[model samples]
Target: MIRKVFSDTGALAKAIDGFVPRQPQTDMAIAVDAAIRDQGQLVVEAGTGTGKTYAYLAPVLLSGKKAIISTGSKNLQEQLYHRDLPLMKSALGYTGTTALLKGRVNYLCPERLERQISECHRPDSEPGQLSQLVKIREWSSYTESGDLSECDALAEDSPLIPVVTSTNDNCLGKDCPSYEDCYVVKARRRAMDADVVVVNHHLFLADVAIKETGFGELIPEADVMVFDEAHQLPDIASQYFGQSLSSRQLQDVAKDIHIAYRTELRDTRQLEKVADRLSQAAMDMRLVMGEPGYRGNWRELQTSPSVEKELVRLSDALDLAHDVVKLSLGRSQLLDAAFDRITLFKARLARLKDTSITGYSYWYECTRHHFSLNITPLSVADRFREQMAEQGGAWIFTSATLAVEGDFAHFNHRLGIDAKQQMTLESPFDYPNQARLCVPRHVPETNSFRRANKLAALLGPVIERNQGRCFFLCTSHQMVRELSALFREQLSLPVLMQGEMPKQRLLAEYLSLGNALLVATGAFWEGIDVRGQALSCVIIDKLPFASPDDPLLKARIEDCKLQGGDPFAQVQIPEAVITLKQGVGRLIRDQQDFGALVICDNRLVTRAYGATFLRSLPAIPRTRDLHHIDDFLSGSDTDSNTMQSHLLDQPIEG
Candidate 1:
């Protein structure tokens, strides 16, 4: 028998209010608790001021059911596991076991570490590679968490991850000599016994994908799963359900083979032969991928003879690697290590070749020093639903931008949830009294790319009106750069661009400057907070739209078309609506937060779809004139009537 604590939403809210310090956080706690206790699916849209994290956590901790909380980024994962959980646990007076599970790449492998140390002593090694290996040796003894995140000296793009980490296709499982001491296996075991596990979305999707392939599972059974940043689910799911291979992986294979030969080699010449084949395969792949530049969809480039030739060479290299590994199968322990490496490489190549791209989109991406081929499933709704059913767990998907206008069709359909069970919770933060939506009238709808210059001119007066504590959000980097340069020359305020420094550091500088204008692109539009007077104005250059020509977007649209669905209505519109809401939401982050939103995009007033975007916004006082916005900011008398009169003076274009 379960002990019933709080009954309805009201009772739960009161209980939370009495315990937790913040009022809005208490409300979130109640909703989360009531939903979990009833074993129902929930969709919540909490605003920036709602204290969402504590609200969800309180109910989860008190319910006594095993819960898994999935976040969107690794940074957030660390925050939850290292900072928030311990504080919340103590404040709520609850005692429960909790564990943080990350992707396998985060942990150190003792076997791989020994091999790296051995290779560092070679005569041809890079100048600083030996010193870095020595540092790793010293750090390994004192590192209790076994997480690679603590190592600041290692670059994220280093060759270490593939060598030290295990992927599903690469892991030797219990057969490995170091299986008993494996960090990845140990972490999974700890998660199984804990009451709550914190994992990122990528890891969660990978576990789901592995389950589909009949591999061992990563996450343990849970009664409930709460996806914190629910908006990123679709894109993340596409990655897991897709196929990808990189030139870097092939190069790593060659390096590992060379290192393995130094330890155990009955025939050094054969090992050299395998290394040469692997190197040639990497070079062939690079040549086929062309010069290091953006190569869009794979279908467009699939007909190239060079690509075809390299694919054959890669397959042949894998076969040769298999033969060499087979020759040293059960001999020395080091030979066994070489066999494991070769077997993993062979299996990965086979998976890449045979992986079905029937219901998915395929693309090739090239960077400065790497080339990767990617295949992403257009939709993972059915797969997600099947996973939910198998787990037999209730889910609560919550984000500030889950609904569009008053409908949940896009979010619900994308996740394959029943519409009848979905609910939209509006922000408790007062909007009309605290915020104003200003649409500049002089902006043009011309399709010319030079409209960016016109946009900068329109933004100048609005920035002046708000005294320069502003966030100018753009849809692309090119626009951001152009507008930033214009703002620096035209406006007297200090102008900051996104790429000048790290995002967090830049945000800190902006806040410290107190009246600086920061112009940035997509990443800064959402999941950012600037309350009080630090952010009194927000200028959006245009409606956020997914590029139709983007490889991933094209693939997704094509997949939807094949399924007899309207890709624009199903995918693009809702995604943009959600993203716009996030950008607008940055303006008023607290109850005391007051600001003006100036959207330079003329389509918001000229297009029929503009109503959809408008309805999704907060019910703030709105205007489409420059003078009224100036008056409102200047503390003049401007009520709903004044806004209406100004709008009536000019004909409504749409």
Candidate 2:
């Protein structure tokens, strides 16, 4: 029956305009159906070209089950809800409704937006700000859902955004003036009534956190949970389980108070003064911390006496802001929200200041425009397991990359999942025939110009031969900048760097310019799909490894050691393997796609641990010869397309 659902005349196939069925997709559909029927847990690693989305969605629609489809990327969420779901419902002729729901921060709080527009219209408001407000106000009128995505002109992190958007701590639920037409309420109601709800991991984890607290809920009644990109769930879950306070939050609070004080029923002068002080405190806190960079663990920062004194002043200013906002709480819901936010912010800061708390780690991070302090739990497996037990639903976890080396032990243990069944489905693409692996013999360190030039020599010919259809992925931003500069100085092709434009725009340019060498870092590593000749080669600077000095990485390492485990073999190596796999996965997106994956770091051929990274990749031909790589990219290597390689079947856990 599951196979029939994907047949040529089946509803899923008929609903889609140009649908083709594959054996792996049908197999996945069968597995999902069985998992749902048994009310058990499943860990499935499906390779690219498996049509995993439809494999899961077809069963979900056919079963008439109330399911929550959680994805890692918002772009994917929108794609599913807007395109995939509608096509399935229409083709299958299903009666169930589907809804797209994102985190609270994604939607515009109308009550807050109206107040902002009203203030922006005043004579004292800057012309530029008022102009932006008028444009937004115009958009809000016709935007049926009031989603921020409708206003493409406004950047997500714009100062104007905090003026209109509301967070979990500041939303005026049913007491707001726009209660009747609240977009969030309407969206939630749709999800509650629908058979399937689509949500990103952040919103899904938020709902879990909210339900655990016994608060008023938004998670609909669901019997099954379908997780796409499940590899990221465990890492993202840690964020929601922990607590953090950022300069952005404080800035938002101060901005809200300033806007609210203009019309509150109290003496506006004192409140305005207090609001300015609060904003100043937030700014001063970031200033005293450092000059636009991460200053890990507050303990390291406390040695600077001036930083300590500024922190004290920030605390005092918070106290004053909270007291003033409390006095104006009854004036309006906005003021009430400001008061609540101030109180919560102060409490979080207090907890962060307390060093006696066990089972947790604290750190401070600063950037050019913002700073943050986080109190993160050492581990969240127990809490995650508890939630899983409480939910008592059939959980289906699927991703392209999940296993370390044909084994799911690392993934299962990290998420505290006891899987009833598991499977690994390899991609149908002919890797040995379709692609080549090239690793130069001489590894170039970052600091050496001779090495950079040598590295450029190794890559420049490949790019020129391939007509500039390549991606240079690095582990660090500094590396990206450095490589981009070198490329601009040497090779002449339409060079596009990551931060030069928005991701979508950059991708568009890359697609349009058939021969373009795009230099990027982590953002382009995954979640990007460019098939055919547009992206024929991927060059990675080094193994994609998280910096050990990073606070989060340090905390995770300590957490594993406390449990009597090797952090490198258990944590660091596995992470790097998975990330390298993601970068390599970009090569074989379609059956017809062909590309070369190049790693300049000779570690893969020289170091003992390189075997682990090599095993995580598909069993493909490998070579240290650059001539074969050049011949392959030039499409002239006709002598037996497959090169022999000593491929390992397992990760070297030692």
Candidate 3:
């Protein structure tokens, strides 16, 4: 290991010098540098204030190895590529090229845009659509990035994405007229040649799921694969392996059918009939699934024989549309457009039939007025293992909560990594001095889920004491709504609920409000930062446990049970530990951040397995007395040692 003080003038040393290390961050950086330099795998759990980004980046940039950093969200991806990576490169004096690669749908296709504009100008089109189409034409001329994100008129969930972009399933490949000028292909090519590629877990898993060559395809094999926010990989993998066909795909087919065969029907009457049938089929499916609502697991809602019959009828109409286009293949642009749409629709329908249920689960979902059938694989360990073996690179999976009480068995097993090589580095943050963990002394565990009134009654005093800069993180929307209503009635603070506004906007409002209390679901538990005095308390309503009845969870637990493992111990416990850590982490985001973490779930104090959860947290001063929390928040000079002693006196449940 290269040992040097914080002031060494070398590139990596200078970057380290600028970074203020709170013991944990410096130790983690040294460990990561050692692991990378020695060509080995290491898992480090650096706490919230540890500045893990610089710890990992220092070694990654200095090692001069082609690295692929996968983050949990697009927001994080942009943050790294645009902000962190550039800053680190400048600080370290490294001149390596890097590229940010997003999914294909984000980019624009000139061919599809031209076709849409051409169709809009036809005499039969509605005036409103023609006007919108004209705007797209003007924007398409000078847009160099070809990214739809730059277009304000386009909504992220718009059906226009599929119409104007390409997917692996429907991409015309080299056969298309715009193949040479494809934006997606261009971005991907850039990723292949770059020294470091930044991507989200979704795109990374998509590559793993679809590309089987194991080498020399889209992403070049790298020397190391660093999963920055490694905790989200499993859930993201579940999404990619799942199957879903959207109503938008069907609707697009209907529009293309009209475009292709409209010329053949001189009477315009027959053209309207085909369009109406396709539209009706889509509407019926939407009605069945409830358009604009996110419904999971469509198996519960049975489709009658009539609905199935209509699908067949729609499929036949699509076939007829395809045949018409095939006949006019060499003749007109209109027929060609219809042919492409018909082909995409048929392919999507075929995928639904071929959807695998043995190792995965399927569901029908509707979001933003679009309906889709989704299928997700139960376990991705086997697939991830294959990638690891094929890539044969040094892999480092680190997170604030990868282990429960120093055990990496659960996370390692899920990701198919060897547990023997694992290492756990606790956050060097002075949690015991700077923070406190509070579990309300007595709360009934038996009726907790059902008795919302009682739960809210217990939460009232705690909220009152904190003076509203609290995040009431609940496990379900039902709890969030119930608590928000109760808190609003009892508390004097401005109470904001999750669904009141978009999450990012809501967080912004919450911070701006200064002393407002926010009731939110699991979305606010992690990947949220409320620095300074804005957030002073984090109240967890219950232990974060995966629903036992959830299909994905059930499948994973069953698989674990079959392998002679205790599903709760091996899976549920570790999963909850990581999640609870995320919730507790929200309170102390910065070194100056001092707050209280109150978990109202009595199970943490009464259950035999509770010690595992407690051990996973930082050595914080804990208390069961509501008065101590009141005194601490009130700026009273309470003895910190007394609080620590009180926590130690509590019986270790296990």
Off by over 4 Å in 1: 1-31, 151-182, 211-220, 287-295, 331-357, 444-446, 460-469, 484-517, 626-654
Residue 380 displacement in candidate 2 (angstroms): 1.5
- The local lDDT score (0 to 100) that residue 484 gets in candidate 1 is 89
C-alpha lDDT of all candidate models, in order = 0.74, 0.80, 0.73
**What ordering of candidates by TM-score runs from best to worst?**
2, 3, 1
RMSD of each: 4.4, 2.9, 4.1
Measured on C-alpha atoms, candidate 3 has an lDDT of 0.73
Highest-lDDT candidate: 2
Span of 10 residues, lowest total lDDT, candidate 3: 1-10
Q: What TM-score do all the candidates reach, one by one?
A: 0.85, 0.94, 0.86
Better of 2 and 3 by TM-score: 2
Q: For candidate 2, lDDT tens digit of each residue in 1-654?
A: 788888877766766677777788888889999988988888899988788888888888888888999998999999889988887778767798788887767777788877877787778887798778777878888888888877876875577877777777777777788988887777877777777889888888866765431112544368889999998988888777888889888888887787777766446667788888988988988888876656487656765888788778889989999887786668777788788889999998888778567777777888998898887777777887887787777899999999988788888887898988898888888888888887765557544675556777768867877789999998888778877888887787888899888898899999999989999998899899899989989999888888877877887898789889999999998888888888888887887888788888766766788877887788677777777778887878754434574232222221
Tens-digit lDDT track of model 3 for 1-654: 223423344454565444443456667777777777666777877777667887788788888888888888877888888888997888777788898888877888777677677777788766676666566667777886677877877765565667777555445566677877877777878878888888888888887776621213645568877888798877887776565667777676566556545544444455456666766777676765554645555444435565466567667766665665575575545445556766767776666655444666656666666687766776778877877777776788888878888877777777777622566666656686677788876654735446567767876787777778889898888788988998889888899999878787798899888878899987888889788778887888789998665656776777788889898988888899999998888988877777888887777777778888988888888887767777777768356887866683377432
- Candidate 3: where are CA atoms >4 Å away? 5-18, 21-23, 34-39, 111-143, 148-166, 169-182, 212-216, 255-279, 289-357, 366-370, 442-450, 652-654
Off by over 4 Å in 2: 7-20, 122-124, 152-159, 211-220, 291-295, 445-454, 640-642, 645-654
